[model samples]
Target: MPYVPPPDLATLSLPEIAALVAARKLPPVEQWQPQAVSDSLMVIKADGRWFHDGGEIRRPAMVRTFASLLWRDQAGQHWLVTPFEKQAIAVEDAAFIATDVSEQDGALAFRLNTDEIVLAGPDNPLTARGDAETPALYLLVRHGVEARINRSTWLQLVELAGDDLCLTSQGARFSLVPSA
Candidate 1:
């Protein structure tokens, strides 16, 4: 997708921008072959803060806009891909953070830092690293991209964990720990 700034960005509300972002179709980055590989100073920290040139990107709109253009190539490399250009960026961890969560209609829904909503299920399954007491939780967001579930959200999910270490969302039960 091309990075076209909205003409009235100053006037457009966050929800409006989010709607536009959600409505746009991303380009087939896998098919794009760019000869120039430029180094981007942008880095997504482990806590999901985006930094550029050693400074935090304070604008949520800018961060969310850039996030819409993010892509991961088959070679396991991350890039900010556009129709006309591609730049490599650094990711200390997952590119996004699930900052809030709620249970609705028997399913758990998460609100990402980018202001996008994702439901936990087979398509966006939850996974954990480390042990039961101190697990690092993650939720798949998009094409091979994931968001780290923040501590609060993880705690909420933990409360839902059953005796078998399984979580039920939207009537589907998912095992948080491997069965013996």
Candidate 2:
């Protein structure tokens, strides 16, 4: 079997979330309704440096990562749009996809729109520009673990920790820590 992501998130409280997930009160694909003080379509991290492995100096880059966000809202499904502006940001996104290259042809591979992609820039994120602290909800895609990225050329990723899929965006790694 392969990895599958959930499709729903219910409520946004940390402890309650943990409990519901642990107790299996929610389904694998439950909708998490979280209230954000800002926007949820985008999340940008502070500026950082992307360096070469051999002590070489590349241009510094920032971080832009998002998860379970809706960029486009259509009749039922929405089209995602990424806001990454730097080549470096694209590079990192591509790398993440590259690592998860799927040999199942196109059957298992996937592409991320804005929900799973982020870009970095020189300036800091303003309130209106949108940051990770924005209001957003989670919709667990209750399908078999599938490759969330494709092509591996320019990708955006937010690898979160999964304690039953408790996704936290405001963190060093923005990882989804298991909600035990």
Candidate 3:
């Protein structure tokens, strides 16, 4: 489907817009089973920067709006999905990045590149990949969707690491490193 900006998008505050996005009931793309695929020129870089036609999408709001429509199918393909159409896009790594993090009420809250907030714990767990020297951390953002932990956020999380190599949030303990 062709993209349409909300009529009040320009007038709404960030929180209001976030609420509006949360309230949306997107079509079940996972169940759509589309047999046709059309490639788009958009690419989400490994560093969580988005580009279209080789130009960086510099506007944060525009990036967030596009991200709000992102979907990943069972085949592991990513798309910018709308109710009427789905456009395939390339993702070098995760679709979004956790650019900022904070702890509140015993939980770690992450602010994604798209301006979406996620609380990390059991439901939205944190995990690290790669070796200790170059570990890559990630956080679950939504249904089968994850955001790469940016360098600064990774450092912040590292600071919370316990002697046991575990991080506790919301009364849940997550191991920062896999057990030997």
lDDT of 1 by residue, 1-180 (tens): 645444343344445544654675655666676777787889999988999999999988789878877887677677887666789989888888998766645566777887766677777788777776566778877766789999887777767776666786656666665333
Candidate 2 has an lDDT of: 0.24
lDDT of 2 by residue, 82-124 (tens): 3321111112211222122111211112222322212111111
User: Using alpha carbons, what is the TM-score of model 2?
Assistant: 0.19
Question: Runs in model 1 with CA error above 4 Å?
Answer: 1-35, 170-172, 178-180
Q: Model 2 segments beyond 4 Å from truth?
A: 1-30, 39-98, 109-180
Which candidate would rank higher by lDDT, 1 or 2? Answer: 1
Q: Which ten residues in a row have the lowest lDDT in candidate 3?
A: 4-13
**Clashing pairs for predicted structure model 3, backbone only:** 1-85, 106-170
Better of 1 and 2 by TM-score: 1
Error of 3 at 101 (Å): 1.3
